[model samples]
Target: MKLRSLLFVPGDRPERFPKAVATGADALILDLEDSVVPERKPEARAAVRAWIEAPREDGPAVFVRVNPIDSDEVAADLEALAGLSLDGVVLPKAEGAESVAMLLDRLPGDYLVLPVASETPAAVFQLGTFAGVAGRLAGVTWGAEDLPASIGAATAREDDGSYTDPYRVVRALTLFGAHAAGVPAIETVFPDFRNLDALAAYAARGQRDGFTGMLAIHPTQVSVINDAFTPSEAEIAHAKAVIAAFDANPGAGALQLDGKMIDAPHLKSARRLLALVG
Candidate 1:
């Protein structure tokens, strides 16, 4: 599935579920963890279940963000997911391959797993280990909020709202790890959904840095996120031209394209873009 924009909806708020799906998000993550209060857990799970089982035509792929693996509520969340036709679950506070495996062991079908890889301090070191379970991962993402609280940091970002140096390293690790696992590198939420200008720049930065998609916190940010990740007409044209150039000159190591040096890596990147869009 194309994941250029994945929006999160509070699981307890069933009223917003259809609205979220109608927002043109590539996927919907029905959140049952941070979004739901303890008292509303049962209500949220039932709502998520009903929505997934409801009759529907075409809509976004649905993913449920279950509570932390070690939490008491996780079992109930798993039970709610049983027999449901859904895309996957977003495992939060995910530590390593073991956590992913534990979730998989319970899920009966071939459900894809998208783990929020870096939440706790210990999760940072285990990011590389996710390659062990790459076959089932939809993508790997990281969280900046819980990490800061875990380490007692004032903030995960700087005065300019950019991630601090530590979080930058964490983000880089998650990006590289996702690539190593042969899955899309999904950027985390931008948070300031109303700041279209800043959100556009943020999503652009992620796309430029090789992230295939980004998480969206609000419906309004979906289009901006999708636009950022999608290749422009000129980009598609350039990619096609590069493919043609390489195909035209078989075995040629280097080629001239628009008076610039284009070689093996360029050809690989061009193929990647076309493969993604195609």
Candidate 2:
């Protein structure tokens, strides 16, 4: 699926499910963890299952963020979802490849896995190994709040409430690792819903750094994130032109295009863009 922006909806709030499905997000993540309180877990799970079981329209892809595999609720969550139609399971507090392996042992192989890179201190170091998680592992993402609390350090944020350098470094490293492993690097969410400018800048940065998509905490942020990641008309046109020029001169290693030297590498980049367009 071409998921440029995946929005999260609290599982307990079933009233928001239909609205979320209509938000134009590439995917809708029905969150059962962090968003739903302990007392409401059972109710949330029931609501999510009911929503998934019912027939629906051509809505966004649906993923369920179940509780951590290590938690007591893991088995129940798995049993509940195993009988339903879900695009994937967003595993929270994933420590290493073993955590994914354990889940694979329990869940069916057909289900995709999107692990939240690390929410605990031990997980920060193991982020590199996320690619090793086999069995339809879709992508890797991270959370700042849990990690900081695990280490007794404050989560990094600027005066404007944007993620600080430390968190940005983690996000970049996760993206690099995902690329190294040849998976889409799904970016973490920007919590500041009110700061549209900051959110746009963050999404743009993710696109520039090779991230395929980002998770959204609010529907309002979906359009900006999707726009930042998609190739622009000018970019698409330039890519087509480069390919056309190369096709017309197949033997040439380099050629002039708009006053600039277009070499093999430039042509290769252009071809990738054209591929995206097609």
Candidate 3:
């Protein structure tokens, strides 16, 4: 469960399933939603179930993205996966906490849930309520394509290829909502797998903004995303130093460390970083 990166693999590509586990990602998402078309839904669902049933050399947490509850395909998907040993279901276009609760009613109690809030305008506003759902709510992510369309925007991306301002707003909202709900705020993927540098930069930015991790479209991007999210040697050292300084001077409310003022808040941040590294 020490997830730093969750890599997605097309459900129909059973050949690539083992390769995905070998990527050293924290989790693998066998996608049955966007990646699988109408014609291939049945095959994709079977392929994911088969992969889950088989023995595996790698033990990365296994997840599957089922079609949304509102979709016609969901009934069949749930019936097919009613009692399998699934780590979770990635609910696309979650309407709100109520929607999540409804899905939970259908799903078994043991299965974890992660909802994508970028599907519709109503979902964007109800990001705060996802935490109230029971079970292991993994985190919240947004879909750029769905949100812009919901708002009737011409494009989710700007001319510079960055998310438009409204999408940025939703991203921030999702981040805060996840944090408030006591779950990780997972950043969405950058679809352009060809541009490693840009992907790295964007992942690094997400890390800076307090997102715990990110999703990956391609397995090749796994290393970059994991590296960006993981605490570096220097960072760990600094965090340890901050914790030590505060621990050694318990009575003092504020003190100077390395020419900078150290306080309780800074010490807490340092400890959180160390926890991540651990």
Which candidate number maximizes TM-score?
Answer: 1
Q: Which stretches of candidate 1 lie over 4 Å from their true place?
A: none
To one decimal, what is the Cα RMSD in angstroms of model 2 from the true structure? 2.0
Residue 29 displacement in candidate 1 (angstroms): 0.3
Q: 26-87, model 2: which lDDT tens digit per residue?
A: 88899889999889989998999999999988788899998998898888788878868878
Show the colliding residue pairs in model 1: none
lDDT of 1 by residue, 1-278 (tens): 88899999999999999899889999999999998999999999999999899899888989999998889999999999998999989999999888999999987788999999999998999898888999989999989999999989999998888999999999999999999988999999987778999999999999999999999999999999999999999999999999999999999999999999999999999998987797
Which candidate achieves the best lDDT against the true structure?
1
TM-score of 1: 0.99
For residue 187, model 1's alpha carbon misses the true position, in angstroms, by 0.3
Can you list the residue pairs that collide in candidate 3? none
lDDT of each: 0.93, 0.84, 0.86
| lDDT, candidate 3, 1-278, per-residue tens | 56689998988889999898888899999988989889998998898888788776647888889888898999888877877887888899898788778788887758878898768998888988876773468877777887777678898888777887888899999999888887888999898999999999999999999998999999889999999999999989988998888788878888888899988888888988888877
Clashes of each: 0, 0, 0
Candidate ranking under TM-score, highest first, comes to: 1, 3, 2
